[model samples]
Target: MFIDTHCHLNHERLRDDLQGCLERALAADVRKMIVVGYDGPSSEEALRLSLAHPGILYAAIGIHPHDATTWNDAIAARFRELARMDAVVAIGEIGLDFYRDLSPREQQYRAFEEQLRLAKELDLPVIIHCREAYEETLSVLAAHPLPGVMHCWGGTPEQAQRAASLGLALGFGGTLTFPSAQNVRDSAMCIAPEHLLLETDAPYLAPAPYRGRRNEPAFTRIVAEKLAGLRCLDLDQVASITTQNAYRLFPKLALPP
Candidate 1:
């Protein structure tokens, strides 16, 4: 009962051989995955994939902060339409990313607030992607209080506690398996189990054994295995806990038959 709370099945490699990817994930016991979007077109593609795959693949639609320059009332309206789709569960992978700063800081701020407002209005949970902008992200969340997961969380234990204070769950990924990710692991250790979520951010952060290779949902098991060690729990315990946390956060995730 594993759930990859964040991934990019819409990415070229996975989308090109989508059915095969699904089989591999299921074979690895991945029960569900969120195909996250970083832009309008990507959101549409994510939704398309989810609609096709139904219960197993779900969508989180939003423009990532890197693409915040695309923000506007018209685009906002279009995103609203997409949110209405059944398979679209949340408004995300959205938040600040000072590390890359691909968009103007001011533009990122505006787009982040705008999308937060949209999430507030639509009554949807968020999927935040904060990197080196934890405080800035917290500032935005302070203004708009919507519950969600901190997708790909990379903060200290204090920051993890701070995020938990704001009703957010910490997303632990392949980085947990990295020798240098003791910081992330420290954060994971401090976070209460109820505030933990497991994600692959697939086609990106593959766990240690597959690091540097293209990541896939099947590798989510590697992440779970690593987290199980960090938390001193068995693999099945970690899976059940994270899967329950995911369903609680994204209630729209259809249960498997």
Candidate 2:
């Protein structure tokens, strides 16, 4: 079975037709997914979506670097409560994003480090998002020493190796399928299958020939197909390995590990 280890099905774009989306995913053999949150409301929604779907979905909660400025005591308290919930699998879709820099750099560091400590205290794995700040992100992670995925990894070969050295899996999604994404393919080829996870980042980076369209969990199959092609492995092998990797990273997934 293929697992979309990252997505945003809880967001408004897909929430309205979530049932249909899931059905399509199931039909496409996309059996499991991780719904991510970038803030408090979305985190709660992710938890709810996971509960409703049971084994078919799990939730990763955190305030994304984009919204790090809003990470106050009240939000932290709420995340602490949410962290303990049954459906919550990880503390993430979190980390640094210098590309957007929506939040002040100092605030991003504060929020990232604070959340890193929270994940350690809660004993939960994390799902990280780093863009244009791979070195800085790795430095922070080196200090905290947490288990997480570098969600949507688009870094260089050296950074990829460093991430693997840190015991972090690199998440690959629709970008892998882009005609201009040979670099992503190269990185995917170098990473061990055990240190790899698949995602759609749904309502976002949809794979071609579905590019520019609204992405959904169903398109994760397309991403998997692309990875299979890159790895020169059969689709079943990619599916089995990546699913195992996802389970290994997020033990809170209520399924066979």
Candidate 3:
């Protein structure tokens, strides 16, 4: 069985046929999925999905940096309330996204810090989304005490090393399947199996064969294949290890029988 450590089932692409998408994923041996939320509404939707899906799906609630501009105490309070839900496994797809600059850098930092504190307070793991702000993200993480995974890891070997040092598992996705994404692939190769997890970031970063198309949890098998190739291991071995790693990070997930 495989685990899609990060995905957005609450997004519009998957919302229409959520059951079908999950069926296809299960057919492909993708047993468990962590549906991520980026903002208030999405986070609530993620929690609702988790409730509907029960053991098959779980949730991670947080506000994305893009919505940082509108973030306030009320939103944080809502997240804290959601975090108390049994199905809420982590506090995330949260972090810095300097590439988009949708929200001011200061606002992003403020939101990130607040969420980090929330995770720490809730004693829940985090699923961070960082883009083009590795150093700044790392700096903030360094100043905070939290447990989490770096979702869709797009960092250099040095940064991966630092994140691993802080007990943060490095999440690999379809980006590693790209031939030109040497940095991401190298980072994947550098991470130890125990400190690594697999994700698709669906319907976003689809793997090679499905490149340019909408991604799905089923495509996570391709990600496992890539990681196995990069690590010189078998597909089943990679799947087994990554699945175990994900369970380690999010103990709320019920493992496949």
Candidate 4:
């Protein structure tokens, strides 16, 4: 079985044909998917999807850094309310994104801190999205005792070590499959398997053969293949180990048989 640990099913790319997308995912042995939400409406949709799908789908509710420009007290309160739902597994898709700078640096930091506090308060793991701000993100996380996964990891081995040292897992995606992604590949090779989780970040980062195309949970197999190659392990071993790693990170998931 395979699990796409980070995906945005509520995005327009998949929203129109969610059932078909899920069916394709399952057909490719993608048994479970975590639908991550970056805002209020998407979070609500994610929770509703989880409720509708029961054991097949799960939700992560939080605000993304891109939306930090709109972050306010009312939005925070709404996120808190959503986090209380049984179907909501984590507070995330949240963190700093200096790459886009869509939100002011100060606002990004404030939004990231508030959501981290909420996750700590709710006693739940966070699913973080960090880009070009590894140091800042690490600094913020260090200030609190929070459990989380750094989704779409793109940092130096030293940074990967730093994140691991702080008890956060590193999420690997299609970027690892790119021939030009030596940094990501090297980090994946050195990171502890137990602290590694696989994700597609789909409708986005599609792995090789599927690259430049619309990504889906099914393409996670390509990620597994690349990881297996990088670690010199068999495909089954890679799949088994990473699936277990994902289950460990998101214990709320109902693993398929």
Candidate 5:
């Protein structure tokens, strides 16, 4: 079975047709998913979905770099309470985004540090989101050194090795299938199987043939196919490797089955 380690079923695009998305995911052999949150409401929604679906869906909650400005003591307190829930598997969709600079650099740093501390305190793995801020992201991760996946990895092979050395798994998504994303493919090839993960970042970044259309968890199969080809491994081999990697990084996922 394939596990879409990062997706957003809480987003309106996918939530509106939730049943259809879940069915297609199952049909595609994508048996599980991690519904990621970027902010307060979305994190709550992610938790709700995981609660509703039990073994099939799990949640990773935190403030994204774009929403870092909203971080504060009360929000941290709320995340602490929510993290205690059985369905909230990790603390994430959290990290830096220099590309957009949606939140001030200082605020982003503070939020990232605070959330990393939160994850450590709760003993949960993380799911990081990085864009044009790999150095800063990697630097923080090196300092914090929590177990997690670098969701939708877009770093160099060297950086991929750096993150893996820090005990973080690198998650590959639809970008692995893009013709021009040779660097991403290269990173996928270079990483060890134990440090590899698969994700879709659904309702966005759909893999080829289905590119430009709304993405969903079912398309993780396409991402897996691309990775398997790049690494010269069978599709099922990639699936088993990544699924075990996901379960290893997010121990809560292993609890269900």
Candidate 6:
């Protein structure tokens, strides 16, 4: 079985056809999925999905860097409350996105720092979303080390080593199959199996042949296959390694029998 460590089934694109998506994911052997939240409403929706699905789904709730402007004392309390719920596993999809700069840099840093503290407070791992801010991101993480997964990692091999050294697992998705994403491939090749994870980032970053199309949890199989090919390993090996890595990063994902 494979776990899509990060996806957004709560998003409108997939939620509109949620049942079909779930069926397809199961068919693809992508058994458990973590629906990550980028804001308040989506976080609630993610928790609802996890609660409704039980073993089949889980949640990671936090404010995305894009929505950092929305972060505040009240919002933090609400997220703290949500984080304590059984269905919620982590404190992210949080970090810097210097490329878009959607929220002011000041707010993004503030939100990222505060959320990092919150995750530390709750003793939960994090799901980081970094884009064009590896230096700053790693620096902050170094200052406040914690276990987590760098969702949809697109950093260089050096950055991959740095993240792993800091006890962060690196997630690879459809981008691993992109022709021009050599850096992602190289990073995947360099990271140890224990630190490797598979994700679809579904409703986005669909793999080849499915590229340019809407992504889904089913595509996690494609990512696993690609990672297997890149690592000169069997599909099952890749699946096993990544599933264990997912469990290591998000302890709550490993549901009771």
In the predicted model 4, the residue pairs found to clash are: none
Each prediction's total of clashing residue pairs, residues at least 3 apart in sequence or on different chains, is: 0, 0, 0, 0, 0, 0
Task: Please state every model's RMSD to the true fold in angstroms.
Answer: 1.2, 1.4, 1.5, 1.7, 0.9, 0.9
Candidate 1 regions with alpha-carbon error over 4 angstroms: 255-257
Work out the TM-score per prediction. Answer: 0.97, 0.97, 0.97, 0.95, 0.98, 0.98
- lDDT per residue (tens digit) for residues 1-257 in model 4: 88888998888898888889889889878888889999888888999898888777889988899998777888888877877766778888899999999889898988889888888888879999999999989998999768889999999988998899999999999999888889898889887888788899989988888889988888887898888988999988987898888777777784441
Global lDDT of model 6: 0.93
Write the residue-wise lDDT of candidate 2 on 96-163 in tens digits.
99999999999999999999998999999999999999999999999989889998879887788889
What's the alpha carbon RMSD for model 1?
Answer: 1.2
Local lDDT at 34 for model 6: 95
**1-257: candidate 5 lDDT, tens digit per residue:** 99999999999999999999999999999999999999999999999999999999999999999999999999899999999888899998899999999999999999999999999999999889899999989999988989988999999999999998998899999999888888899999997789999999999999998889999999999999988989999999999999988888888887763
Tens digits of per-residue lDDT for model 1, 1-257: 89989999998877887888789999999978899999989999999989888899899998899999998898889989988877899999889999999999999999988898999999889999999999988878877888899988888889889999998999988999989888899999988899999888989988898898889888889898988988899999999899889889998895452
| Residues 83-163, model 6: lDDT tens digits | 887788899889999999999999999999999999999999999999999999999999999999898998999999999
- Per-candidate Cα lDDT values, in order, are 0.89, 0.89, 0.89, 0.87, 0.93, 0.93
List model 3 lDDT by residue over 1-257, tens digit each.
99998999999998998888998999999988999999889989999998998888899998899988777999888887887778999998889998999999999999899889888888899999999999999889989967789999989998999999888899999999788889998898886678889899999989998899999999889899889988999999998898888888897785332
Task: Tell me the lDDT of candidate 3.
Answer: 0.89
Clash count for candidate 1 is: 0
Task: Point out the worst 10-residue segment of candidate 5 by lDDT.
Answer: 248-257
In candidate 4, stretches whose alpha carbon ends up further than 4 angstroms from where it belongs are 255-257
Worst 10 residues of 2 by lDDT: 248-257
In candidate 6, how many Å is residue 185 off? 0.3
Kindly report the root-mean-square deviation of model 2 from the true structure over all alpha carbons.
1.4
Say what the RMSD of model 6 is: 0.9
